[model samples]
Target: MNRVDTAVHVEGLRKRYGDTIAVDGIGFDIDPGQVFCLLGPNGAGKTTTIECLEGYRRPDAGSIRVLGLDPLADHGELRRRIGVQLQEASLPARLKVWEILKLFSVLYEREKVPWSLLDHLGLEEKRDAYFDKLSGGQKQRLFVALALINEPEVVFLDEITTGLDPRARHAIWDLIRGIKEGGATVVLSTHFMEEAEALADRVAILRAGKIVANDTPEALMRSIQRDDEVRVHVEGSLDAAAIEAIEGVATASIDGDQLIARGVGRGWIARLVNGIEAQDASLLDLSTRRASLEDVYLALTGEDEYSPESPATEEAGT
Candidate 1:
């Protein structure tokens, strides 16, 4: 890929609170117009790293530049150019949707795109509703709309769809894509593996306050060395010798009546079918699949879920 102008850049970023170190020397870059995802389990410092980039918190050690300006030193200039949707955003309970958007718009020198932004976020009809009256998903949409009112050059979305249902989540994902297409860079921190895989151009996986893996989703999936597993259901019992004769068959195992074969690539399915047909055995069903990002996460971090067990453990473990 060509080296585009860097929208956000970090080098050896570190942060600590008293005795606990939250972020430990992490570094990455986001190119212009790219959807860069900071992925990790809870307490992995993904939020802290994002806070540093957003100028919400200062780093103890390291450098951060967003849109060619230092985030900490130039926070005034940086805030004008970036929009942030915090993980736990709150508005006055009685504030109307339009009131909140209009209030935020006044903070920026540029005029807020309230009308188009509200329409795009599906908030046009809810303009008169108070913040407390809206549902979780609707509130999330309103928060996103507020973030984009200023037409920022870079948008930081920290788990923007955490409480949304599947339909609402997909809608927000499409809105995010539209944001990227409109020439703004996006830096999102998410725990959902599918969300990262579906949207991120490149992902940085953080664990224990450090980066464990960083690459495109496809590249990260291919990095795992487990041979692809193909399941073949034969009509009748097949001898082990016949299964071994199939091309690209690394190993074959019989689970009850089904034949499970592990192989390297795509041709294994055809080869297995041909081998079975030659033996006068009918093939019942066959399926081939590769590993997903969830598998990759388990293999690397050894965690089944992203949430931490306890706050005390989270602070102590890191």
Candidate 2:
């Protein structure tokens, strides 16, 4: 593929801290004008890989290109073309909103006018508010504004919506959507399943320092057929033993009056019908739902749910 057609391209990227390997030979490509998400649990190296692409950390081995330029060897030129909102961002507590924006604007050769971000981010009322005085949501917006001051061709965000309430998180998602619409490639690392499902044009799921899964959310789910589930409703109790013995049944459970079974494929529906009939239970209703992204995550990593178990989830603290 023509490298210029891709926004970010990584191959055999590796990073380590002494004895600990953070990222291990990961590779992927991101298209321009798309929102790409890096997803994983704690210590999965999502942040490490993103930092390497942002030129914040050099890789121990392998290559990465952002906007068709080497992020490390071409630091100065790359910085001018890329934006970054780190997971843990802080500003001088005493500095007002506009003051910091002005500070960042002067650092770049070309940048959006300082006040324009205040208007664009709907922070005109807090233009003079001190950094410490702003609410969690407002501070996040300021960080985004700073990242955009340079009007970069690509942006990197680490845990963008961490610590935000539902309303605030939705607002940030909208802002990210708008950024993509405005023609900036956004690469974000997040643990939120909904965030990945909602925003990412494609997602890469990392685990144990390696790239385990990378694809569109729907494609990823469909790729893992065993995660699909079927729900059956019956007036009486289910024949738990017979259902459990059925072929393709990965797991079977009872929820209220429903007998839920997850199987290897849609063919499980046939196995389920046979099992139910042999038990003489009236199958009132049978329904099927495709595997979700969360299900795929659990299946690939064999870990807890993607969102709730991550340390980032605790950091969100909401």
What are the models' TM-scores? Answer: 0.90, 0.80
Best by TM-score: 1
| Cα lDDT tens digits for candidate 2, 1-318 | 233799999999999999999998999999999899988877889888988998989999999999889998999889988998834345678998888888888877554556877888879999988888998888888888989988889988888787788788888898899899999999988878889999999999989789889999989978875566789897767767779889888888888779998877547779788888787777889998777888888888885535563442366311
Off by over 4 Å in 2: 1-3, 86-90, 227-288, 304-313, 316-318
Candidate no. 2 TM-score: 0.80
User: The CA-based lDDT of model 2 is what?
Assistant: 0.84
| Tens-digit lDDT string for candidate 1 (149-191) | 7788999988776656778889999989999999899998877
Which candidate number maximizes lDDT? 2
Candidate 1: the clashing residue pairs are none
- Clash-forming residue pairs, model 2: 163-316
